[model samples]
Target chain A: MITIVAKSIVKEGKLETFKALAQEMVEKSRKEKGCITYQLYQDIHNDHVMTFIEEWEDMESVEAHQKTEHFEKNVPKMKALRHPSSEMTLYKKYI
Target chain B: MITIVAKSIVKEGKLETFKALAQEMVEKSRKEKGCITYQLYQDIHNDHVMTFIEEWEDMESVEAHQKTEHFEKNVPKMKALRHPSSEMTLYKKYI
Candidate 1:
């Protein structure tokens, strides 16, 4: 399985909207094939920082996820709510 | 529960040693009270980057963990293995 860690710093005053969008994405993504988990987290120390920790069966699953309607629609909206330097990295389980 | 996402870039040639140290930390940490999960992951796109996704029952549990012998001993070693600009963040689950 592969994991994706997508972290971003949400712009001030846009957290609620961003979160709503994220929740929609999560809810839809979780129903997709090969999706083991899809959850959103907000930094306790920095409320503006948010992350999505996701588990997928393979790279194909991840690619497919990006093509979904929810992804295609919401991701750009989410990005517009974030500051610069946001990052998303795919990881291979090591332990 | 609270989560912690610790990301770092391991120095060249230090991945193996870092993984070994991380494994030991994970084993010891999982046995600690309030620890739900403590796993290490390596970035697929950048082999030198690693991340730790952890869950704890509360902030106190996290504080207690920092005082553990295993944490004290290994975290420093792990830091030494990493390049500059590494970061550890505490998060509150929003979903």
Candidate 2:
């Protein structure tokens, strides 16, 4: 299994809207095949910061997730809704 | 090997403070033995959202980290300065 941790900085005043979107995204992602868990988190120190912990069965499933409509469509919307320069990382299971 | 994904929601109006903490934590963690990578991220849509992606050589290392002064001390401060809730998960590498 592998885990993907994603973090994004929202605009100065979009925390609420972002939270709603995150909640929705988490719900949808949880139903995907090979997804063990998908959770949305808000930083206790930053009102505009959010993160996600996503677990998948393997790389193929993760890659598939990228190709899904949920990702393709929402990514643009997510970008449009956020500040520029969001950070994302992918971790391969080496253990 | 293993990966730990941690998410925390800072109280409203504490983004900068939390970011600084996260930055310091990441820096300290990266230098530890068995740590492959430790990165801090802020959500693009929420300033209060913070996430961490930590890769370790094994569960033993991870457990050891928990006992480090860096963790034990900061954790309480982390808990006290926040909105009272944070989420953390450990992932075992199966791939």
Candidate 3:
């Protein structure tokens, strides 16, 4: 499986909207084939920092997720809510 | 539960040592009363970049984890294997 850690620093006052949109994305993502897990998290020390830890069956699945209507539509909206310099990393299980 | 995403950039040639030490830490951590999950991953695009996605029952469990013999002994070793800008972030489930 492939794991993705997506981090973003939200623009001030956009957290609630971001969360709502993210929830919709997550719900849709969960229904996709090859989605093992799709969940959102908020930084405990910094409320403005949000994260999504996702697991997919493989690279094809990830690509499929990116092409979904929900993803294509909402990801830009989500990005608009974030500050510059936010990051994402994809990892392979090593242990 | 509380989640922690710990990222580290391993020093060149130290990935094996870091992984071995991390495995020891994960095994010990999993036995802790409040540890829900403790697993390691390596960035697929950058092999030297490692991450630990951990889950604990609460803040107290996390504190207790830091004080354990395995943690106290191995964390520094892991740090010594890492580059200077490695980061750790704690998160609370928001979805």
C-alpha RMSD over true interface residues, each candidate: 0.8, 11.3, 0.7
lDDT of 2 by residue, A1-95 (tens): 76677767788777677766677677778889999878665554555667676878988888888888778867777777687767665654321
Give the alpha carbon lDDT tens digit for every residue of B1-95 in model 2.
Answer: 67677767788877666666667677777888889888775554565766677779987788888888778867776766577556775655321
Q: Provide the TM-score of chain B versus the true chain B for each model in turn.
A: 0.96, 0.88, 0.96
Better of 2 and 3 by lDDT: 3
The chain A TM-scores for the candidates, taken one by one, are 0.97, 0.87, 0.96
Per-residue lDDT of candidate 3, residues A28-94 (tens digit): 9999999999999999999999999999999999999999999999999999999987999999998
By DockQ rank, best first, the candidates go 1, 3, 2
Provide the global lDDT of candidate 1 against the true structure: 0.93
Q: In model 3, what is the error at residue B72, expressed in angstroms? A: 1.0
Candidate 2, superposed: residue stretches over 4 Å from native? A1-95
* Model 2: residue B61 alpha-carbon error in angstroms: 0.7
